[model samples]
Target: MGVTKPFPASVPLSSRAYIDRMDAGLTSVAGAQEIISMISSRRIVTKLILGHNELSDNGCIVLFKFLGSAIGRKYQITEISLNSNSIGNRGLLAISDYLQGNTVLKELFLQDNNFSEDPEVFITFIRALNASHLEVLSLTTNRNLSDPFAETFLPILETPHLRELHLSAIGLTPQSGSPLVAYISSPRCRLQTLKCNGNSLGFRAVKSIIRAIERHNFSLLTVELHANHLVGPVSSDNTSEEDGDEETGGPASPDAWKASETQIRRVLFRNSHLKRETEKEAIRLFRYARPLLLCSSKHANAPAPSTSTRCTDCSCSEIPSPNAPEPEPDTPASNRPPVEGIFPFHALPTELQLYTLSFLAPSLSPAQRSRIYNFASSPSTLPRLGLCLPSFSSNSRNTCVLDPASMPFGLNANTMSPGGGCAGGKCAGSKNSVLCHKEKQRGEWLAVVGCSAYDPYREGEGEGVGEAGILPETGGAV
Candidate 1:
């Protein structure tokens, strides 16, 4: 055996030792122990960077346990980086358990893991993380997941301390969408920032969560739902069976449906991803309806007379102009009507409505939304607009930017106002700040919401909707 070196004469305590910084980059998993020893020795070492190591599940468990138990809680180790590790779901689970009492850990990085492969593990981890004082959690670039994904996250929604949650490139499931939906609808979910990019979440799941937070409530300060299969580039004027969803179901909550649609409207309006097919679908539904819902002082009534082609009768001005001439009249137009019978608002199955809305939403201009009254209200004590629509501030990135047509992505940012910081204080000024400005700070928050949506393929992150919601032309109130 080689001669052992003598123990240090004066080892510094984690909380008392002073150091500018510490770089614990390990060449191998075997070196993580050395890192822990070094951290445990330095009583005041505030930051430790042991990321980019190929640590396995076992390695991660060992490191996190030692760090969280001693240096993490005993000495106030605020910053720790353990990214690029092959640590699977088990490693993450172990880390979560260890981090329960570590409050000084203000910044932690553990991205590019294998949690998505077992979504149930990810869901369980998040649910438990809700109870911890975790400010920021990033799980970007997870590859094992892709589509038909869903897992429980209501615990996170219910978490009182957590402010930001990042799950970009995480293949989403329909079942997972419910918690997100409940959180968006819940007034107590102290959710400030949520980012999910490059996943397989379809319009059905997206519509649910987005609807609950329609009209850009102040509670949801920062949101990033980007680079998914649901919204992608296609040939111009694309109209095929693939353009629609796989299936449709009856309405579960008429109020939730309306609420979700309005939220989608707001998102689409702010950043229109519109195309010819999307616009045509919206018009087709109106064509079949014949007359539109009439605006009333107290109660909603069927249309008494045609105002101006009703909601769909207006001319396709590049910008909404109330003064623009009306169409020849939908009544005289040939009756091709929508494929589904009855008006979408009254007859189409809820799931069908969701699909139709996803296809046609690119056409609903937020500028025109100003003309419609708050007729769709939920029984859940939500505002008349269901989710209160923030007043359109011209300077606000959350304001409407609906085009002459609408969005191809089916989402509208009209409701996502650049409101006060975050959905709640737990989000803003903390991890939420990181999410709100993630697009602008990808190099910084490398483990967050995957890459920025501005250009998923970009080197570093670019601005996201919350930071840079600037859209091409077409204006409307928030």
Candidate 2:
């Protein structure tokens, strides 16, 4: 009796099918072409995973024709994984044709193929990426990939939509690393994850990469630099020192940097075996480093704490006179002075600070008002405008107060009482020579009325208060 064969299920020609490993056991070109013919006739398969098959140029051409054809476009085939299949220049060239017109495909994995011999093939592939909507591309283990094709890949690397790039084990050196650093540094690049492990990128290249990350204000989440010849984790040290305060909201020192590197989940350097057990140690440090880089609630314009402007206990809040000496740098954390005030004004939100200032401004006397304005006009107050009330004029007849009754603009200097120092360029007709300091300070007499008079973000030193003596009467405000 003859054995009966199992019948194949009927699949609709109009329906989209998902095929995976259809050619795993089929090594013949004819067999691969037969599958492509069935796909073309049926107009099915939204995903095709045909890796590890000996599909050379002829088989690839057959697949590309169907994928690029008008009928193939209707099926919405969005993924194609053809890895380790002996694909070469001819096969890639054929696929490039499909990529030019195809907008539906989102991912392409052509890793471990043989397209590195001719540089033009990679160039052609780069051009194809420009026209395609492919978001993720992996060309791993193409060992011949080097500097000759670096220029060709830069545009693709900087592609705004290409969020993930995998080029591991591609024999890349500083030649390729230089251009890659440029690409990563560019604000145009939207890449969030970069895998360039197992390359020969040296320590200098890693330094360049770190500088780019900071200089460009990178938003990358993960970067793998494992199994490279990188001399050390020097990038972390440098970046930590440069951006430590900003990242950790703390001091700019090595400890803070190490703390930041451990806290922030931004970089990855697991297998950079530079010193003996160094990579392991770095990994261990980051693993145990408590995450302190929490999201801050301060307003965007609020000034961050720095050596010059640290006000831990508000001791630095003594408003400087127009002639006050330059402030000393903040002391070390160990030698920090004890707190004196019940209210931590430095810890308050900028809006709250402004609100408090507004309440305090109305109650101050005319003399006190002038002193506050003098303090607010200093360089330190520019960055913290939310606490400033107004920019008073340098006019000698100015009363500095918002009250209309004592307005000095229309009244003569001799009309006011002596205590008001309106005489001798002093307040309320008073001849208080001690309170009336010289007005030779630069940017000291700005007449603009509102907080928006000068932008703090713009560059300019509005005359520093170096070695100038503070008036005893206005010392508290200054």
> CA lDDT of each candidate?
0.46, 0.52
Among these predictions, the greatest lDDT belongs to: 2
TM-score, cand. 1 vs. native: 0.43
lDDT of 1 by residue, 1-478 (tens): 9999998787554335433223344543476677667766664666766666666688777777776663456766666666677778778787777666555565566767665556666565666565556667666666564432233445344544455667787665444565566555553454457787666554566654565555323334567765443444221221212324332442224554455456655654442332233234333433332223221111322232222221131222232225555334433222334446555353444345334433333333322111111111111111111122254322233322333123336645443333333332222324322334322222222112111111211222222212222211211111
lDDT of 2 at 27: 55
Minimum summed lDDT over a 10-residue window in model 1 is located at: 375-384
Q: Which candidate gets the maximum TM-score versus the true structure?
A: 2
Task: Give the local distance difference test score of model 1.
Answer: 0.46
RMSD to the true structure for each prediction, in A, is: 21.9, 27.0
lDDT of 2 at 360: 38
